[model samples]
Target chain A: MTVVDIPPPLPVRDRTALHERAPGALSPMLTRLAEERATGVLVREHGTLHLAEGRVVHAESPLAPGLDVLLTARGTLDAAAWPWTDDIPAATHRLLVAGLLPRGALELCRLGALYDAGYFALAPSSTPGRFRYGTTAAAGPPGAVRPLRAVPVTALERETLRRRELLHRIWPDPSADGAPLIRADPVAPPPVTPRQRAVLDRVDGVRTAPQIARELGRPAFHTLVDVRRLAAAGLLVPRNTVPPPPPLPPVTDPDIALLKRLRDALEAL
Target chain B: MPGIDECLLEAMRLPGARGAALVDWTSGLALGTVGEAPGGDHETTAAEAAELARLAAEHGAFSTADDTEVTPPVEDLIVSNRDSYHLLRFVVTSFDATVFLHLWLAREDGNLALARIRLGEMAERLVLG
Candidate 1:
């Protein structure tokens, strides 16, 4: 006789208590999920991370290009892989069955894009993250494309930290990240490389680093590096917003309850 | 035809292979790794190796004449210090060619010539899916 063991369900009450403690709790939230060996989608302000049994299966962010964009941009994907990509599993299945991509192309490309988005998804922000428990990320088999590789949360966090340090080492100031850059020092040329030139040419005082990355079909972190380098070279204008997020005072809001009371009294009058 | 683990294991079959890892040079993420790591940690080694790989692949001086294709500019980089030989061979894929195979071997026991040739072959056939 064969006995199949079922995984335990996610504890609902414990997670409900976590919501009140959030608003800047992505790290702790991910740690809790890892401890639970839970399966679900972690939805955040900047992106979403799909977790499967304590591992990060997929991460998506607006700052990073999607797998479709990366594939279509390369022009190497078959026509079938393009439209059918609406559903990841089906698209991967077709790509594999059709022998369109090599054995690991889909997985590699997805992993590349996954790291890009994962970095942004794990960025320290003031917004809270919400984890909805489910099995969407756990449906894939060993070699399925939907869940290419199950990355340990510890590994993901470490990689993300390394990337952050790399970016910091490249250019300390992060104003170029979200701010439009201008050609600040045009008189003296800094002798930019061809790749840096490609990134610089996109700088029109309108597009930010992420926008430039999207335009060039490159990772946003790479663009951030280039932007920071350009800024360091005294070529691009830096935004005034350079300081990191500081502790904020209590939010001030109008007395809506008193206003409603006054209105009710006026109506009675 | 070999997956990440199988390919790394094949690299380990080399005479003096100490460790091997498949790293994405662009994002500095190790797709898979086997055997020992250079600094006793694969993540740090992968990051440092990626910095070197990116230094080669990103510059115009090292770029190949062929600009039409999406392949990386440099093929592989061989770095040898006091005792060991580090080989980083770029893996050209359908989407992007930012991935590379990193093999660590002792200079005395390792065969650089044979390892480079075998690593090149492994990079060509490595399947990550």
Candidate 2:
């Protein structure tokens, strides 16, 4: 009896090859199909084209409005757009065969994420058959597009650091407090008012009025008065805890019983 | 190809360059900024650019046929004035962040093609890691 040997996967090789491709050159990412055949997905910064069983599976480009941010921003697609949704893979296969999504609008980032997630999910991990690529795609439930970057996993931590740096450039305060580590200085009081200026200067993130008064060797109550006055003048902001959510009463609609009866009858029918 | 930072500088080197900034799409924050001192604060500019990106992205998703499954990922945004043009180029790197480079240029002195080419190169060089 003759034995048929199955071929190993191609994503690992394809990833290395794609990484080695010249910066400006077109890159093709090869992956193995369930039938043990070679397949590929050509990837670029702005576009992607997928091939299966020696045929084009899909093609996408970002000439105008890109597609990734579109679907997610509108909250239209979730991972359903992944490479192996039940109806989608087949739909895309047919579309590719028929030339529908050729140079089609692909939210490139989403495409990238789907490809990465699908490729990693199927390529000989603990879980198998969960989300197989090269299969029919199905419509997924509504969800948001998770973030996907081009950097490899090895560099993810460093990438996160840099991403945070970039994020801070815009919103210096990522927290709910919306305040920087170093609080803003109070507005300058008139030169004659040393008392107000002293109060303003002591109102840093660190010490409270009591602490400041203790350090200055002054009476706590007098310092508290000054602090309160400055705070009232809109020159200072003290930390405050977030308020709790209000309570809700139980529902007591008079039509509830009637609705329940109607529902029970519909179920019985 | 230079990284996103270098790309903004190259953009600023353009003949009537005004200012530039890079923004994150998710939060609408500027990653970096250049040029426009008198225009406004960087935070304000970044916030405004983010708003534009959000509007454009929403519009694209609404207009798409796959509204059920498709959303527009913004690649670039452009605005023109009597004397200048503002360009926003988005780069979706592997880390799941959407970053955009904002460039402002004088229409009369700027070369659109060169600016675009430079931006593309910069996007490729941007080291998300």
Best by DockQ: 1
What is the overall TM-score of model 1 with all chains considered together? 0.78
B1-119 per-residue lDDT for model 2 (tens digits): 23344556766886667888766544444545677832677766776777687566545443445442122344567788787788777664432234577777779888777887776
For each candidate in turn, the TM-score is 0.78, 0.32
Scanning candidate 1 chain A in windows of ten residues, the lowest lDDT window is A138-147
Q: What is the C-alpha lDDT of each candidate?
A: 0.77, 0.45
Q: Candidate 1 residues B80-113, lDDT tens each?
A: 9899999999988765437899999998999999
Q: After superposition, how far is residue B19 of candidate 2 from its true place, in Å?
A: 1.3
Task: State the displacement of the C-alpha of residue A136, model 2, in Å, after optimal TM-score superposition.
Answer: 52
Task: Kindly report which residue stretches of model 2 are placed more than 4 angstroms away from their true locations once superposed.
Answer: A1-269, B1-4, B61-72
lDDT of 1: 0.77
- Per-candidate DockQ values are 0.28, 0.03
Model 1: per-residue lDDT, tens digit, A34-87? 889988889887888888888887888989877776777657674445755455
Which parts of model 1 are misplaced by more than 4 Å?
A: A1-26, A83-86, A139-147, A238-269, B60-70, B127-129
Q: Tell me how far candidate 2 lies from the true structure as C-alpha RMSD in angstroms.
A: 23.9
